[model samples]
Target: VFFFLYIYIYILRTIMANLHELPGAQADSVPSAAKTLVWGPGLEANIVLPARFFYIQAVDSSGRNLTASPGEKTFEVKIVSPVEEFTRIWIQVLDRQDGSFLVRYRMYATYTDLYIHILLKNKHVANSPFILNGPVYHEGCDCPQSSGSVWETHMHCPQSFPQIDRDLALYASVDPERNAQEIPQRFGQRQSLCHYTVKSNKVYVKTFGEHVGFRIFMDSILLSLTRKVQLPDMEFFVNLGDWPLEKRKPTEKIHPIFSWCGSNNTRDIVMPTYDLTESVLETMGRVSLDMMSVQANTGPPWPEKNATAFWRGRDSRQERLELVKLSRAHPNMIDAAFTNFFFFKHDESLYGPLVKHVSFFDFFKYKYQINIDGTVAAYRLPYLLAGDSVVLKQDSSYYEHFYNELRPWEHYIPIRADLGDLLEKIQWARDHDEEVKKIALTGQQFARNHLMGDRVFCYYYKLFQEYAKRQVTEPNIREGMELVEQPSDDLFPCSCHRTRVGDTK
Candidate 1:
């Protein structure tokens, strides 16, 4: 009888231990709504973006953190106006599958105070119904204005402010003999160039080439920006190509031209690309400036992602081809491949079997992302830096407006143009795991702070403001120019919406 009792006790203990090790163990550990924790920047009421975010962590009855998601429907978040109970706001709860949840909500134009309720399994979280001051803006659909006083000045723009003045100075003096007003008329008709004028905050365009889409997209951004700030009347020529217009070496003299990107050798005034600010995601619709922060916040934590370096793109440059060879030589360290092979089609067998296109978010799965220049500057650099993974960018002269602010080791790991130092850098990343993770996080924070839609608009406003200061004569709408109307909210229903309160006139 004594032996049998001992056996029974041992068997019961084993069963309990096995149950604790099972996948459903979290189910047994019921989340205590009262003990759950909630915090993050999204909780702040005065944030400039229309979207607000906060984090929630599940805890048990004993206040211990839960290791996994409790359930899909476990956490519930609701944002409601305190004064008007009927007021509705859009709210989303993203489960990180690690006992934590990211809650995002859209801010609407309302005078009353707002309250955010966080609940787990129908019970209130530790700080449920957190109160926040309503947004001060009058329009519901418009981008929220910064409450801080420094937003309009160059101080509110990126660190590239000095570069803006220098680029404008390149065109500060046109050909001494030519009239200032005639400069656009003489050079605007060139291929891949367009003349743009802002009269009373409206964008007017005259296309000289087939790249009308670029002008339309840029005008859309300008229109969105003008709604928030009143830009001085200005006219400028825009180069709509991968190469800067000044670099093209037309027989005519170099003129001040705005470009999406520029090189160290080029004198083009670089501006933000619509592709960087508002690229469309397959799952998520048009990703606007406001949604950029939210998208950047997505993806797994650093430790949970793959440790190998990842690269995927077309065969746009020889450096990219060499990267694939290096990856093949060191498969364990890197995973590089071409998704399309046009430039080197003759060597198809050498790098054949093009891989399928990977989703942008999936790129975050790797510990390090390889950013190689395609034509000029890889437009994907901004989006890559926005992710949680560290970017191993190839050194290139080509740069965007904000590249001046990005420090090499501080923001990203710089690789050689030929990718010769890439292996060494990857090994270094492996050796200093914590340091690389910090760099990744710091880069992400930099992007979130500077590359957002609001900041892009601010950069444009500052650039145009500086350009307006140097105008020799008043800008007038030229013949053949057409008005580029602002895009409607219906086009970007996911990021933009019309509130019941009314539109800002």
Candidate 2:
């Protein structure tokens, strides 16, 4: 037995030595085309319930194992909807031994296309999209038995739909058409903008995949209309977001409308929707409302909180790095750090010593909160506004759905993008304590009065009601296409328990 074990161990060591000598073994030797991305087992088009670990490996063109190269040249993964690039999640890569990396995403939400972008020195070496589908299984249902029914199913889970916040009904306004020449009128009226007809007459919304933002907008609109909107009854297909025509191979012929565009500059010609994060209605699940209550309950009032302006988030862009630099210079007056520094290249001496993360409640401990632009407009703006701390916002071109309504100085102080005047702004806020407190109260009032969940639904209902009329003809919600429901698990499957990689949610 000992002799046999010795021989087996010897063979394994020999294999490892030979693998290191392969052409693709070293970073310098491997040609750009020679590198390949591969998925681990059970990562099929229709994924099973109780998701398994999603793994992706970096290999040589010849299929030999190779460790993932980090730093300047590395792998970046995201799962985004083709039509509405608005819905996206950045997937974090976990390094394994040899040349493979595990994609640490729990398959809780159903998404299509694994968007992979491999860059070397900021140049794209390879970009590919692979399909990743969700299942039709119920929480208590045996998923394996009905696994084959995933593609044929649509909208079985009612809980996945966004519910109407009846308390916010007061925010609903008169139809947009009624006030085409002026701002619409608002009153406390429980009116259904659109009504559901007989099942055959109902319009079916076919989502290419699950996008939280898109889903919220669509679901709210549908729920307001009682799910009456549907595809047109005529021949052909329509497109929403950027559903690729070449890649779409539906089982049936249908009309597709090019509706709902976001994220990228490619604006939708019909129903233009901005980032939903601006409203508390759509992002209730992503942002903690409990934090707001906690802030109001236990934290000190504006005058008693920490005087330093605080900010913490991923190092997604150069602006965030600049914020960190300022914090380092005035560590006592300002607090900042990279929520996760592993993804970006940074000077350790400059950022490492000060790197740290704070809890959501921590914002209430400080009298001022810093807001800056991330990949898009900062998603944390609404959350920050709820903290009752004076907000020091940087100038940004990116706007959310309701950004136009927020006035600088009245609600929050606006700083230059270069952060040249952050210190001056901070000093001014401290000197004018009464004025700062008023601004903080105004920002908090805006969030409480206008950005609540139901108000968000009202926006969707109005937008869709107007958009629905613009269709060449009244859209008929007849049944004939495939659609999928969003997942409603309290916690989305994630690689890390505390944080989701590259995502605010």
Estimated TM-score per prediction?
0.74, 0.46
lDDT (Cα, tens digit) per residue for candidate 1, span 320-408: 88888988899999999999988889877897679999877788789999999997888888778877789998899898888888999
Worst 10 residues of 2 by lDDT: 183-192
Compared with the true structure, all predictions reach lDDT values of: 0.70, 0.48
Output the lDDT of residue 480, model 2: 38
Per-residue accuracy of model 2 over 157-268 as CA lDDT, tens digit each: 1121121222112223323222221111111022111111112213344333233234455444333232212221221122222321212223332122223322222221
Candidate 1 — which pairs collide? 42-53
Query: Top model by TM-score, which number?
Result: 1
Q: Which candidate is the best by lDDT?
A: 1
